[model samples]
Structure formats: structure tokens, C-alpha cells
Target: MALTKLVQLENFRKRSGSETSVAKVLSYSYASPLLSSPLLSSPQVFNCTQLDDLLEVYYLSPLYALEFCLGFPGNLLVVIGYVVCLQEWRSINIYLFNLAVSDLLFLCTLPRLSWLYANGQKETSPYACIIRRIISYFLHVNLYSSILFMVWVSVDRFLLIRHPTRNHFLLRPKVAMAVAGLSWLAINIQVAPLIVLMFQDMQKAINSSRCTDFASLSGDTNSFGYSMGLTLTGYVLPFLGLCLSSYNIARLLKVQDAALQRRTTSYKRPLRVVTAAAAMFLVLYSPYHVMRNVRIASRQEWSGMELCTRMYIEGLYILTRPIAFLHSVINPVFYFLMGDQFRELLFAKFRQLLRKTGRQRGAT
Candidate 1:
């Protein structure tokens, strides 16, 4: 919001003609109208508001920097660990591996924003706008495809338990690749229009140009439709599918023996994994999307927020960025905790403990 205040102040300056120096500096980008009122000519657009400028210098930049520095490295490490530590050739693991790669593409753009803001929003360019859009496209695709793959994994488990004889085809390697491909294609179809609507030739409102959901900006009708679509496609359906599968799996386990139930629950760690992934999704993404949709519905600018609203939005930064990074990081932890092969590989210490316990019981 502070950064937005600075831009608005710049806009007011560009409205009155007194601030020739500021206009001259921003003119190099060829997007002087971004801050200036469109009706005012460049020479006429000079004026400044004191309170707005003071807040910009004091608040937004430092807070944004602190958030980014903590999230970036952890996001990168998630992808690296998955590739090196995970064995290849399984379909589910491959999709997760690629998901991490997509998130890292997003992680890479933060420093670009950090630099742009640290320089007082002067270094922003049209190319940065395009980069932001491209990164967003990939990130959205990852969001959809990752959830779709998880649903597929869940249903496959559901079938494997309920009808183990006939539909075992769901577990094949080739079929998983086909599922992955179909997931990517479907998400691409959903998000391709965002590329057309990206509005990347200019920068606006400070550093958020580094990442954005431009689909939410296409006037009220399109904005409402886009949010609904995102809410349904990215959120509602995924959560529903996960809950349904978990419900069925839990029900099916209820009639089994105690020993079998323990073993089954141990192997069902993927349920917990998916649940954590969804929680992180809600944590990081919900606030950003909700605020964006609210902005669209109200048809107001970002700067008009009251002090409390602004602080709440700013405060979400602590949860939002880290959870986004955690979305990338926790998948590897999921694999380490849940993957059957990795479990076998790492359970050697547990094996020793079990053996010692068995010997002690026999001696007694």
C-alpha cells in the first residue's frame, strides 16, 4: 500500500505541471500515463501529496523485502531435493517433480521485484511485465495440474482398495503419463486467455507487477467470471475430490482387523500429505485471491483502503509468501514421509528397534 501511495503521489504530480523532474525521469519508460492522469498532458501533470509520500518512504518497501528474503531459498531447495533424491520412472513422482519446477519459476521472479521496489520503483520495465505474466501462467498451471494429479492418485488408491481386480489399469506407468499430459493440457486451456489479457506493456502499482492475476482486471463481468472459475477450478473441485476420496478410504478401513488397520493407516500417509498441501494452498492463496476479487467487485483502487484494511493485507505477507514457498518445499517432505521406496530406504533404524524389542520379548 505504501508503494501504491508513492505511485498515486507520482500520478498527482504528473497531473500538475510543477514536477518536471519526476515526469522527465519516468518518461524514459514510455509509460508516463501509468502514474499520471490520462486526461492531463505531461507538462500539466505535476502535484504531490505529503502524507502519501511520507508513508511510501517509511513502510511498504522494507516489509516486502523481509518477506521475500525468507521465502526464496527454501523454494529453490524443494525442487533440488526432489530431483536428486527421488527415483525416476513413476508417474506420480514425475508430476510432483515437475510441479516443483513450476513453482521455482515463480520463485525466480521475486528478486526482480525486490530490486525494482528497492530502487523506488524506477527500474520497472515493460519486459518485467511480460516476465510476470509468463511466470503467473506457469504457476496457475502448476496449481491445477498438481491438484488434478493428486486427485488422480487418490482415486487410483480408492479403486485399488475397492475393486482391485478389474480397474488395476489406473496404476500403470503409461496411463500416469497420459494423465499428466491431460492435466497440463486442460490447465493450459483454462489459463491461455490470461496470456492474451496479460497487459504487460506497462507497469502499475509498484512491485506487484512482479506477480499478478491479471484475469481479475478485465472489467467487472470478466473479473467476476474469472474469480468464479478460479475458485471452482483451482479450489472447490480439488478440495471436494480430496475429501470424497478420504471419506471413502476411511470408511472402507473401518471393518478391518486392528493389525491390518494399523498397517493400512501407516501406508496411507499420502492422505496426510495431500491435506497439508491443501492447507498450504488455502493459507497462501486465499487472501491474495480474496482481496483481488474484492477489489474488482468494489471497483476501487488499491490505495483507497483504510488503515486497518491496509495493515491486514500487509500482515498477510508473512503467511502468503512463505506458504507459497512451502507449497514447493513440503512435497519433498511428503515423498520422504510417504513414498513406499523411500520409506523402506529410511526405516532401517526403526527396523533395528523392532528387532531389539522382539528379542527382549522372547527372552522374557
Candidate 2:
């Protein structure tokens, strides 16, 4: 009986004339003794390769390119403006400077990311893979560091309002510098595990291209859990800090207005600015964090979910990536609006340059 079964399997393999067909035959032949069915047809594999190709080519490519173009010049001007126009560094200035620097670092990755997306293939070369890993590392580092610094900025504003005359330690430049350093260290430590996961992904895809977004990496079963933990620590905590700081500042401002018998509109500007910052924070980050988890969840096998539904979730996740980074462009505007002195100083410097050029032209 075993010999007959083996002969029948070999004969079927010979007649099918394709490697895939023969593999299917072998997969079923060893399972049962009787060949009751005519032949085991190849099972359909659920693949989203074409969907990924289209998303990379259309969505991420243009969006990342736009971010690089808009973010680079704005962040560069912030760094330059800080160095040139500001002679005295305060705690707020320290945080703002570091925030600009973090944005610049993240912006540096956008061009390479844009190229990778436009090409619509994962990187195969070791050098390219290493670069992609570095990009991922710095990307999260910038993200968390930026959030921490912004939280500090909100706290600084709160402190200035709450204790206008007192020199609180948190309001000191040296202490702010220490906080900034620790923030960078903490963010790096938090993001280090992602590098290991990416490395494992790289190893698994040695024969094929790899280096996808973290939500899409197929390295470890714990990736989804890790992502959830990261979102809570990196985003949720800082968001709460910002909200608390902003709320206290608004309350203090309102109290001061009542004490002085001033019009409600007298403090309206600061109140509005603080409220807007918090609102912007929620709008930009909440969707990204939510959709990212959904994307990761969609990759898992579910009882009754369709592949098309998973594709739609991934597409929404892709849309949030660039939108979350739009803060880089909005941040410079905040610099000018929030710091009246800095804006005046920057404008004065530009006018001085213009005057010098005009005088030189006249001399010639």
C-alpha cells in the first residue's frame, strides 16, 4: 500500500509539470492513506505586496518629500536665529534650542526616507540596511525628545506665571541643560530595543529586501506589546504633563486678571496661545498613536477579517506619519509668536543686514 501511494504521488508530480503543483501534492499525500479526492489544489495565500508597493510609491514618497522641503528651512532658521539673535540663554531658550536641534536631526532623515519610499522596495544591501536602521533610531529619538522639551517649555511658562519673582531651580539654565541631557539619554534608552528588532528583521529577510516601518516588521511577537508600552511612556505621559502645565498657567493668569481688576481680554492672548499648543499636540499625536496600533493589530490573523479591511487600516496609518511630523514646520511659527523679544531681535537683525547691503551698494 505504501509503495502504491508513493508511485501515485510521483506520477501526479510528473503530470502537474510545475514546482508549486508538485509541492501541494506532496503536502497532502503524506497526510492520509487513501487518495479519495482527485488532487489537492494550491491554497491561496493572502498577500498585500501590491498594496504596499502602491502605498510606498504614492503616499509616503510625496508626503516625506514635502516634509523635508518645508521642515528643513524652517528648523534651520530657528537654529540660526537662536545662535545669532540671542545673547543670553535662559531655561526656556535652552529647551527651545534643543527642540530645534531635534527637529533638524529628524528632518535630515526625510530625504533618504523619501528615496526609499519612491523606489518601492526594501533595502537589501548591508550599507543601506544600516542606514535605514539609523534612520529609525534617530526618528524616535527626535520624536520623544521633542515632546519632552515641549513639556518643559510648558512647565517653564507655568513657573514664570506662578512665581514671577522667585528664582526656582527648574527655571535655571544649568538645571534645564541637565534635564535636556537626561531627556536625550532617556529617549535613546527607550528606543534601543527597536534597533534589536530591526536587526532581527534584517536577518530574517536576508534573501529578500527588508527594513520596513516598525509596525510592519515581522521580527518578534512582542513588537506590538513593545509599541503599546512605548506609546504610553513616550507620548501619553508627556501629553499629560503638558496639559497640567498649561491648565495651571491659564488658571494663574485668570486669577491675576481678577486681582488687578483688568479686562478678561487683557490675558486672553497668553491663554489662547497655551490652549492652542495643547490642542495642536492632541490633534497631531493622537491619530498617529491610535492608527499605528491599529496597523500593527491588522497584521495579526483574525477569525473573520478581510484582507481589504487590513489594507485600509494600513493606509490610514500611512497618512498619519507625515501629519504627525508637521510639527516641525509649525514649531518655528511658535518660536516667533511665543517669544516677542526673539521675534523683534530676529527682525532687527534682518533689517541691519539690509541696511549694510544698501550702504555697500551706495559706496560702489
Residue 150 of model 2, lDDT score? 84
lDDT of 2 by residue, 262-320 (tens): 55563456556666777787898889999988777666544233434555677778888
Per-residue lDDT for 1-364 in model 1, tens only? 3345447435433321122344443553235454455445332322223332333334444544554555456545545555455565554455555555655565565555445445544425656656656655766676566566667666665665566553566666687778777777877888776665555213333344333344223322355567668768876787688778777776665544444645546545555665665565567557656654554443234234432243344333323433443454444455455343644543554587799999999999
Per-model TM-score versus the true fold: 0.63, 0.83
How does each model score on lDDT?
0.52, 0.75
**Weakest 10 consecutive residues, lDDT, candidate 2?**
40-49
Point out where model 1 deviates above 4 Å: 1-88, 120-124, 159-167, 200-221, 257-265, 300-325, 343-364
The TM-score, computed over Cα atoms with residue i paired to residue i, of candidate 1 is: 0.63
Clashes of each: 11, 0
Model 1 lDDT-worst window of ten: 43-52
